[model samples]
Target: MGKITGFMEYERLQEASEEPQKRLKHYKEFTLHLNDADAKIQGARCMDCGIPFCNNGCPVNNIIPDWNDLVFHGDYQTALDTLHSTNNFPEFTGRICPAPCEAACTLGINEDPVGIKSIEHFIIDKGWENGWVKPQPAVVKTGKKVAVVGSGPAGMAAAQQLARVGHDVTVFEKNDRVGGLLRYGIPDFKMEKSHIDLRVKQMEAEGVTFRTGVFIGKDFPADIINWAKETISADQLNKDFDAVILTGGAEQPRDLPVPGRELKGVHYAMEFLPVQNKVNAGDKVKDQIMATGKHVIVIGGGDTGSDCVGTSNRHGAESVIQFELLPQPPEEENKPLVWPYWPTKLRTSSSHEEGCERDWAVATKRLEGKNGKVEKLIAARVEWKDGKMVEVPNSEFEMKADLVLLAMGFVSPVQSVLDAFGIEKDGRGNAKATTDGEGCYRTSVDKVFAAGDMRRGQSLVVWAIREGRQCAREVDAFLMGDSVLPR
Candidate 1:
């Protein structure tokens, strides 16, 4: 370790962000990255823990300490290289990932953990500023063609990996552009789309072909099929490519099946979130959903609910309230002992701080509206008994709500996509493909494989990238009887 006493001397520091009032006016990233000196200090805080649990803690298994040391020593290029050794896109993870690695840091046993995410952000930004990030085209061509359906992180990583290893790779997306959820689902304020554009350019230079606005399945959801400029049969893709990989996301949103569910003011979180994103991308949306001059109620207390809260605040909502079905988590100090592994504690997001009143253990009984437009909500307090939720007697309440957003989360991948390719599905309706042992990532179909949300269901971008990389290795081995790509 370059700085043996550094961890003891330096306290952990996080990146800074714009004040909520100032950042709320525009849809752009507000969090400021660490400068050279501050990043070095944060890097110094990484203790020389022999086991380095942070490595395994990361879904991509990023070499946290090596890059941390490199950043501390002012070798930014080396640090950037180390960061890219595993994670295909540090910029994405740096901005939005919850930093599970920090939770697993040995320093986090008592004191604060190292700011590994910030250091990573600094290294990648520096590399881009110095024009160090470049494409590496394969030197020799392999007489094999690979097809990756879905241009999300998982498909992107797999295509890039296979392209670097001399395979002719084609990535297909049903959307008008690439990046999938990153391009549409994520708020531009969290991560700008330019990052994805840059990566696409690099991948293009590396002999990867991206075909957007093309639906690869014969049958698709009506709303989804409308986004595609053209359609190609799955049988055609199977016939054309030597191997195929499905990396589509889980998109079937869980619905709130209470009274007044079909009211005009009620909408899925996906319906509400992506329209704003598209408008931010300069797409004109007809009859756009706006929270201005409205009292909005967002259901579910996870990231999607928080995102809805943030977006509503940006739309100048009159009042915003979020409800959670589970009891409120304890404060960090009062959290259970099984921590660091899985932190079950109160967590407040940046969106919550913008402007929101949050409640817990509240279940929606029904929604009341006037003239087919939702205007109020009826709910009751709930308590858990024997792992079952029971409503509290005489605890019913009513509230004004001009709009109700269902942010309860997705159920599974679109079954139509799986059925189109004749792939077996797990109980969760995800593409059934294992991640270990022989035939890993290979679906029941002869040469088709699966990864990311299509295989693992709804998950983080980091996990998607990991699945893509490992799936590429197995595909390589299956094609050539051996492979050199890292898992």
Candidate 2:
């Protein structure tokens, strides 16, 4: 409401990016941010609707309109504070989140939606630039100790919140560094590591202790449970510290079960993406998966597949083709029908624009190879009938594919971690934990609790953050017999 008729006077503006041709040459962030004046204009476009559907669209439930108005009025410090009140890491989401909030914007029904993501990005960058973002150590000590397993967004958020509430927080990460998938699975070009480093610094300053390179089950003996300030047997965690929260991410990747699946040139997207991220982080990966001078085929048509396309192009691949099992959607959604919701439309990613031959309604039937290495792919076209897919008899074809990447999504968290604690699992192999009533987020084992992908299955980073925050509130209440943290 800075400008009563701002929505009518101004149109939405999105951030620009470097051309795909020039950006494909290197692995670095290419999106140009909106300047302060431009960001204010975008913020002004917020109608401040009576009921903000964008809030419903956001998993984190960010106070979008409030912050938008604040930024429009040149009160950015307040805008930053409002933004952080809900989202733990705007920088992370600002860069990689799909921006479902924008899709659900009220303005989207008739006009372009406000550039909320860009304004968010601008608010945070300004916060950092102006030294407005800082760690706030708790004034009183609860002396309660909490153990958070895994160092992904959920674990990190839980640890930070618990520590800020005067609890002693220790984050155990099996990886060599913090940030979990954010550190490895995501390429630096999409998000530079410095953003994560800054948060780690803030968390450390806020009294959150991080123990990396220590796999709980592998590095620590079962008997070492007694050494903790409060020994919680995986069963005792059900009884011991004030409480234990498991926030490990989902890592069980879906695989292609087909002929020649075990060939050398075929690998999972996780296997390939992490090595490049490591190399970008200065770690030498011997015998890295290189797409240079090869015909690369990426299976699956989601973000991971798009990531594979980008990585392949960066490695100077001779040719790259992406495949999707579903039929191609229309280039433009029917706005009249799908307004304010994620629509079923053809979506082109920045990587796809770089250079990729995309095909839909196609299925890989088999892998044809020689000498224990993938050399080509055999595929077929299929059409959907009723609720099933039927293959077209005459559409079988073969294409050269020196390298194949299975970009199919993850299935669940590694079961070994859950099994080690003797926690019950849901039908999907995720830790069985409820989110309401007594003992919310509490496992069947007692004081032990779970959150994030480990508890809710594989999901977005924003959802993970939400789970972490909510789980921390539950843990805090269980410890103090009461709590003030929001759910």
For candidate 2, write residues 1-487 as lDDT tens digits.
9887999999888788999899888889999778979988898899999999999999889999999999988999999999999998999988888888998999988888888899998999899999998998888989999989889899998988899989998887776778888877778788888899999999999999887875654224231111122222354433446778899888788889999898889988888888888788888768898999999999999998999999999999999999999999998888889877888989999999999999999999999888898899999999999979999999999999999999888888877678778889999999999888877898877678899999999888888999999999999998988888877
Q: Which stretches of candidate 2 lie over 4 Å from their true place?
A: 218-240
Give residue 389's error in model 2 in angstroms: 1.2
Residue pairs in collision within model 2: 232-236, 232-237, 233-236, 236-239, 238-447
Question: What is the per-residue lDDT of model 1 for residues 68-162, given as tens digits with 9 covering 90 to 100?
Answer: 99988999999888899898899999888888888788888888889888888888989999999999999998989999999999999999999
| Stretches of model 1 off by over 4 angstroms after superposition | 223-226, 333-336
Evaluated against the true structure, the overall lDDT of model 1 is 0.91
lDDT score at residue 422, model 2, on the 0-100 scale: 80
